[model samples]
Target: MKHAALTGISPAVIAELKNGRARTLELTSAHNIITLTEAAPGECIFVTSVNEEDLSPGDPGIMVDLLALNIGMRRIEVANSFFYEERERMSARIKVQFRGITLTRDVEGRKWGDPTKVEIVRSACYRAG
Candidate 1:
């Protein structure tokens, strides 16, 4: 989750955030908020502790680093229809952080399963390194 949250992001996603299509996101294992397009390359995004936090959408316990503009933090978790409200509450009631990236997750974040996870703050493409 940390790896992807820091890397694995695509230019299109970044563009979306820049265009307002995407703005907030969540992380797995915890309900925290993170902003896409506010983070930069070569940074780290931190969320509430995995065990202590709920991995829901809209959590405000998300934060990122501030590097330049090559890249920015993006949403990582998407909530299921069954657990929307629960996720949003958690997402908006916590605190998180990123290493060098600039934005933080928002209340209505997006989620992508593992494997596809990408930490744009710490990675570039989807090629196995």
Candidate 2:
């Protein structure tokens, strides 16, 4: 992630939209410094939001949830984002892969001489039915 932030774009997610409803996961990173969360659920399947950086990738939960939701699904992978907590704002890099496709993005405010706020700068692009 940091590596990509240095060079260019960060990681990202690639897949078709199964269920547009967002599923957030707060997992402590290996260092336990970052607690990722689902960004706000933006527009539905086909449309893009005005604020592209704020769109969520639609995480539906664990395996059980996936089984239930993926009934009529073909390709679905949603983990393209999470908002950082304001208590400790920092840079972020995310990379997600699904069906052999990889997407990534980076949010580096300090590197650009700006205050790192609690926000996500990555955007998820999904193929609509």
Candidate 3:
């Protein structure tokens, strides 16, 4: 029941998230909130624990070692439906430090079972290395 409630996120992923969260909190006092919640029930509604925000619609936010944009340090704003409410809440409720790589919702936040009705975050050729 406990595991089911949290969806398909693996234990290792959870631990990684917890560790990352702790490290982030330790390194800075920013209030930006990028969290994952279950929007669908299922065989594969895996929610990653990353914000997945990027401003450049046509390219990754990486151009140089630095890009000048505002990412949810003080707040995150998105017109993307799934994240709009979440973004708004985070913006109103927290404060943080961020400069470069603005937050723009590139995909639908919800994971409704039907693939045709939903959109996944654009992470196709991107590698995790």
Report the C-alpha displacement of residue 97, candidate 3, in angstroms: 34
Which ten residues in a row are the worst by lDDT in model 2? 62-71
Taking all chains together, the TM-score of candidate 2 against the true structure is 0.19
Candidate 3 deviant stretches above 4 angstroms: 1-40, 52-106, 109-129
lDDT of 3 at 74: 41
Output the lDDT of residue 2, model 1.
Answer: 37
- Candidate 2, clashing residue pairs? 10-104, 10-105, 11-95, 11-103, 11-104, 11-105, 12-103, 12-104, 23-59
By lDDT, highest first, what's the ranking?
A: 1, 3, 2
User: For each candidate, C-alpha RMSD in Å?
Assistant: 14.8, 16.6, 16.3
Candidates ranked, most accurate by TM-score first: 1, 2, 3
- Cα-lDDT of candidate 2: 0.23
For candidate 3, give the lDDT of residue 1. Answer: 10
Highest TM-score, which number? 1
lDDT per model, in order? 0.32, 0.23, 0.25
lDDT of 3 by residue, 1-129 (tens): 111011222345445443323112111112111221222222222222243332122321210111111233344556665555433322212111211221222333233331211222333353232
Model 1 residue 55 CA deviation (Å) reads 0.4
TM per prediction: 0.21, 0.19, 0.18
